[model samples]
Target: MVQSASIQLENPQEWDLSDLYQSFDDPRLMQDLEALQQTAANFRDNYRGKVKDLSAEQVLDCLQQLEAISQQAGFLYAFPALIFAADTRNAEAKQMQDKVMEAVTGIENQLLFFDLELKSLDDQKFAELESASVLQPYQHYLYNIAKFRPYKLSEEVEQTRNQDSLTGRQAFINLRSLHLGEQEYDPVTTPDGKTCSTEAELSALLFHPDRDVRYEAYQSVRKVMQQHNSLYAYILNTVAQDHKLENQMRGYESTLQKQLLADEVSEPVFRAIMDGTKSRFDLWQRYYTLKGKALGQKIRTCDVYAPWGNDPVPPLSYQQGVDTLLAALSQFDVNYARRAEEFFLKNWVDAKVRPGKRGGAFCWYAHGKHSYLLLSYTEDYNSLFTLAHEMGHGLHFAWIGDRQSYFNSNPPMVLAEIASTFNELLLLDYLLKQAEDNPQLKQALITRQLEDQLNLLFRQSTVSRLELAIHDRVTQGSFDQSFVNEQWQSLYQDLCGEAVEVLPEHQVDWARIGHIYFKPFYCYQYTASNIVSLACYQKYREVGKDFIPGYMELLAAGGSLDQVKALRQYVDVDLENPATIAAALKYVEGLLDQLQATL
Candidate 1:
């Protein structure tokens, strides 16, 4: 697959990692490792048992050293990860990724006493550090780690888990990638006589103007999934078991507790999202009903993405995609456009879907360094928006680099999404404005944009619901594919209600989702992010450019502030408020109304 993508004038499509390491075997990669190991050993020698007696000044010195070590370790590990993401088939990339993760874990194991003993500090000393002006930056970091104090294990046990990780959760994830990467969906000829084989190829056909093309590609993918569902089911079960076992050992109250803690979100926030999103199934049901009428037939799963009224939009080229994205960005903030220019000029993006590259798009950020975007671009509206979404992540990382140190540069997964989705919304608004003279074009564009938001919010929430339910059941015992399919279809019934029908073959979708298999309880952040971003966008409508500085402040704050507290102080959106979710749903409805007028 990996298309011919040159972005624009003299733009490169492959990343230049010389900035990180010259190549996979660069001598500096190992040198960085040796230095990191020495730093860890020396730090342990200096502070292993001395944590209890350290003054506030000494604590500041210890924090600085820890940050330096963590920063360098992050850079070393990020190198191979970025490489493997661009080309999963690269043997050397895979070796280096695994090697770095294993080595970094060893370094971290030596430094475990820093956090453990810090948390064990007497109440007075902990409070003194919390109030010290010099220690203000580390206050939130210190407070967050304190939450894990209850879950902390003996140093030996913690080290064992670190070493075991390569062969445990991460090992299963890698194996699943290897198994799924080479899968071949049968080739289906399009209505225009072009042939295709890859999943990305088949998926593109699913949105073709011709129904025959869409269904042929759809049925072909279903046949392929049927062949692999059992293996996927087994992989999921094994990983879920490991997850449950670890949570139990750590004394976590629930499967989702740690994830919520990591994001600094409360159970109430999650509950509000679930309640708010599920309550609006009627919105999706109505949209599907309208879509079915637009197609002049029943709305099956395959027909959902199909274009209506036979007005096939012209395809965009890679160069055209770049131009459209930057133009839209410039409309909101030329500064963003300026930052985005580097993605093309510096080869910061790997956009073509070559053989065995990871299946989806992500912006991998290296702390204190730059970010690289791995995307599968096909020169369509969806692909264009994907470029914007990931570039949002790239932009966020770049904007935060100079403002926050390495440890604080990464925002929570929830706030991490604000930049990406907000970028998508800006492009959507720009496209909507351009099509205003032609109602037909306007309707189509609005429907497309709303559908993307709906997918991000509603469908992503359903994904998390399925994970929660599956994990609950797995804790009871292992389940077969039939059981897994039933759980998936039941959730479909919940989301679609009595109106929409999910194909039996599509029931195995639970197998194909990569997030749950790799990072359990992760998908809900998409739902949460969309809700929060839309709320932030609502603010933008009130004050325009006046909102940009405050928004920029949140991104720069990163993990330096509490996730919800940052939202409250900077953007004035309270995540725990159910009304926030309702506001996002109302936004969806307004778009649906616009689409209805065209119908």
Candidate 2:
């Protein structure tokens, strides 16, 4: 008889597209598109001049109907964009995405007057409509719209701005994505003699045990980025300047002012986090000093991710990894375990490392039906943590999809990572306990956890500061390539101190972070999320099994509440307090002590 070892676990259930549509060619898609167009046209025809004249109930019903239609259109357009990004070479998928974007753009253009019209209503009428039960669920969003009433432009100007946005500054950013964002790397031979060059491959090299390999990978990456620096710098400068112009027009006090307002967070809270992290820069320096001694090098930025010692890569079978995650999750609650198992069993994840698939992992939930996970799994220890992290995001999406409408499906980025990072913290704690008897594994786990904190806290904080400096300079009409490079060096020096040498070639690092180009002032969320997760992790340790249900409920709340409200409700931490961030740094300090003991 054949050995049972010869059998392998089959891949999990692939995404069920029926809920989206039976297929791309399914008639429902076309019907939905046509219905969306008709709805927009009908809404404009019926409500353009009649909203103020209608009763509160009628106004609320009209807004709900419009939102429902818009939500359907959003799913129709976004699902294809995600599908295309995962497999860009698919001609049909690409065409479908393009068609949907065009149709949605047209629909949006037709409905551009809705917000302005609503804002034009008298205060008493607006209050009555807002208080209507039908619209009460969307009060937060509506109130946010009303908050902008003070700055509302004339209908003609607003329409012009909306139209120009598509072809003006926005088009430049879109062009950058199509042109400058495509980076190709030269292949480097690994120790095993296999050559690899993709971004994912080079990223993995950063974790390689061989110092020479890690250094070479870093050099290659810097070289590639340097080659594109001129173009990248132009894109960066233009995007920042564009933001400056828009913010000035919108009467924002500063570039970051609007972002703070949207997050329902104050600038001082942001300043406190930044100032608090900077004051503890020595923590990062200490980490790098320990890392350099372990790697036996006078550390450089290139050696930052080099492995500490000669240890063979531990191989993890896919099933074993899944089992590990499930077991670790079981500590939380049965629901958490069941949800994770569903991801493995229901085909919700794309785990193969295929050619041209996007690098990095993400959980995409286009509709309430399911969430899709993208990963190039390598079966290493970090890969296991990555799977757990992305699955955490998936579980959050699954829970929120069941509880919220599509319009309210996504929480702010501030609250978004609470679930994902909480999952990572749980997994790390589980692993640490399991390895208590295995000294080498335990040391490695602690080291890895510390590295993650460095990335999420120190590195992200540095990036946030750089973003603020660049935007400030742009607002002052003085931002350029030299300014950005100087800011990068200054921030790096401040964070890393004398522990590592910042190479001249690393100056263009800002250009490589896609977030700067796509999202302004967004890296702060990583810092915020990490610290929030750290506090939540501690709470879990204190409360044990009692904490899981409340955590799940937080995920299920989605965008219904702002970050501050959701976090306070579940984790009982206040973003306004310095103690929250301080507590997380203390945890990192404790981990460092543990690692030093092992050394």
Candidate 3:
């Protein structure tokens, strides 16, 4: 039954994309594309085969030109992408996104030879070039290319793969987007006979205090996935197989090596996170058991997000949410809060819950420009945290844009997640302090924090494990619907243990994970970054104001320095150590103790 909880409603909230471009018909869009194509052609004509022979000053000139071209291309793509994300059902936006992608690919094909030539540079020549003072500015960029030397193919073959991706991997990715965008599920009927239509609306119900509503919403959404399981399975198989074939051709020994190479994370560190998460599955189980005790009912998969205590979640308006978030940031640093306010003032966030908008929240960094955030806000407590999380990403990119060039602005996913998750911890701290005198509210806030950790740490690793199993299965033979379902169920069940019932519908839940299809092996980074964020947050708690300088510097460093070095230098956290992961779990255990005392 729908409880008497009143949802906070306000004026319609939307963002302005005029900063990206006036509209799809904007002449600057086409002019930029044309300019990009010509620049790439001129660049290729100048530097295609001369990378090894160029002087250090000449190499610097080439890189600067390439950086300018890359930035413009990124701007072109961001316009349509932000549009499509705002309303995936917009036909014009879809067409524009597709058109921009093809054009960008052509530009990339033209510029491919420059990188291939750099990769082809022999060790002595590469070292000699690196020693030159003129090339010092791009030392990391030069080193990055050098590491991929073994993976470089002939220019002809590389160009062919680049062009084919339009119809190959990218096509499958697009199909998934369009499928989810255009496909509507059966309406979820609330106890009051109110019917909710879009996936975002259905997802909002999963947090309802009423058990029946959550289960119905869960079943309604999964049933649709079950009906289209075959197509999803095919899409997953095709994309994974393409990844596998490409990895094999690129001389990578395993599917994950390519990502690790890009992420700068070592194999031991990856295993430490995954293995540590599995070893501590009791943390997950214990949390669910605690949840059941607090709710005074048995926990189920559908009730994972249910509110605790007697009171339903209070109605938090969008502006109220922003105020709370900014207050939290202001307590941390006025500069941080000031930067975040610009996002709201500039109309850079799309927070309305509308049909066909993407389900999850993401902050898209527009390279040289400011960041844009997108999310379907349900005007609830959880929505507030989602806002803070993405705002963390926005602030991180803002710092990067102020300090780093285009070549150095892209932080690895692991590092990128720290800034975002740290913001979440800050918000949690602020909320818990406000609820200090109210034991039930404290317990509720603590439960939310714990559950988010479980999702970020354990659940993400489970997703990672399922991804690995599926990729392995594809290598052995093509997998059908049953195989994918069983893998997800087995991994998920292991994580759940006996604490929560895994409904039959939960077996097809893998299809709902866009990351698996969009970027395989991407979920584990959440777990990895959670550890670092916790450590950073822990330091902030202990040192108070003293921790601000290094932390701010860490954010400002962006991708210019090595991530491991950056963490160690600024935050004094080491990613390679098993102790870091153990410290994070121990902190989680402390939260469990607090929750138990409240009960």
| Top-TM-score candidate index | 3
* Distance from true location, Cα of 76 in model 3, Å: 0.6
**Model 1, residue 551: displacement in angstroms?**
0.9
The 0-to-1 C-alpha lDDT of every candidate, in the order given, reads 0.82, 0.77, 0.87
Between prediction 1 and prediction 3, which has the larger TM-score?
3
- lDDT (C-alpha) at residue 102 in model 2: 71
Better candidate number, 2 or 3, judged by TM-score: 3
Query: What TM-score goes with each of the models?
Result: 0.95, 0.92, 0.97
Local error of candidate 1 at residue 250 (angstroms): 1.6
The residue pairs found clashing in candidate 2 are 13-346, 13-347, 14-347
Residue by residue across 446-560, what tens digits does model 2's lDDT show? 7888989988888987898998888878866756678888889988988888999898878987776877877787888888888888888888889987887888788888887
Superposed Cα deviation of residue 373, candidate 3 (Å): 0.4
Kindly list the per-residue Cα lDDT of model 3 for residues 229-270, writing each as its tens digit.
999999999998998899888998777888889988999999
Predicted structure 1: lDDT: 0.82
For residues 1-599, what per-residue lDDT tens digits would candidate 1 score against the true structure?
Answer: 11224345333166677788888768998999999999899999988988989987898899888888988898898888877877677788889889889899999999998888887777787888788988888778878867787888877887888788889877888888876666777899975778887777777777788888888888887787789888888878888888788888889876788778887888888888888888888999898888888778877777778776577777767687787788888877787787887778788888875666677788988776788888877767778888999999999898888688766877889999999999998988888888789766666677788778878877889989988888889779987778788888888877776556677767977776889887777888999999999999989978999998899888888889998899999999988888888899999999889778866
lDDT of model 3, residue 451: 92
Candidate 2 overall lDDT versus native: 0.77
Q: In candidate 2, residue 575 scores what lDDT?
A: 80
